[model samples]
Target: MIIASEKKRVFIYKDTQLSDPSINLSKEAVLNFYANTYPELNNATIDGPEIKDTELHYKFLSTLGTKG
Candidate 1:
């Protein structure tokens, strides 16, 4: 999974199981699973200083989660 903050980034990878509760329903789980499947997202360049803020970060991630 790719997890980033203003000062750091993280990458994780694993085989995802469709039966896993994390994969079965949660959008957060889906995003995390995709990130885990593709760790290169850890290298993505986030645009704007606003995106670097922790609150905005979660808000943006949550938007993706809720939207899909």
Candidate 2:
């Protein structure tokens, strides 16, 4: 008997789709990793892990707006 040991995780930031750099990193870690390139993510929130096909998808919801 054998078991599958791999699952793909994808993160969506605005108009960009980022691939997981490492399999061991947590979702939050992935977010922090990309924060260097996108500073706005520092205050951002995580959305879904919507499953599509065989991949896990996440969205970085930006919190960069003013209250009217």
Candidate 3:
């Protein structure tokens, strides 16, 4: 996999072959892997336009307690 740093215009190539199933990692180990890899993005913030429509998209399947 290839990862690019948009700000720095730097790129990195990852070797997928090295990630064999024989090598097992714990949850903490996996989290630490990502933490150490991208220290800059650890606590990044974002600001964007808020979502206007706060509605449920799907219809409710059951109304067991509803009264007419």
Among all candidates shown, the one with the greatest lDDT: 2
Task: List candidate 2 stretches off by more than 4 Å.
Answer: 1-5, 65-68
What's the C-alpha lDDT at position 66 in model 2? 82
lDDT string, candidate 1, 6-66, tens digits = 4322212233222232324343443455556455533333222233423222211212223
lDDT of 2 at 49: 89
Each prediction's TM-score versus the true structure: 0.24, 0.84, 0.23
Candidate 3's displacement at residue 33, Å, is 1.0
In order of TM-score, best first, we have 2, 1, 3
Q: Can you tell me which runs of candidate 1 are displaced by over 4 Å?
A: 1-23, 40-68
Clash pairs, model 1 backbone: 1-12
Cα misplacement distance, residue 55 of candidate 3 (Å): 28
- Whose lDDT is higher: candidate 2's or candidate 3's? 2
Q: Write the per-residue lDDT of candidate 2 for residues 11-61, one digit (tens) a residue.
A: 999989999988898899988999999999988999988998889899999
Against the true structure, candidate 2 reaches a TM-score of: 0.84
Error of 3 at 13 (Å): 19
lDDT of 1 at 13: 26
Candidates arranged by lDDT, highest first: 2, 1, 3
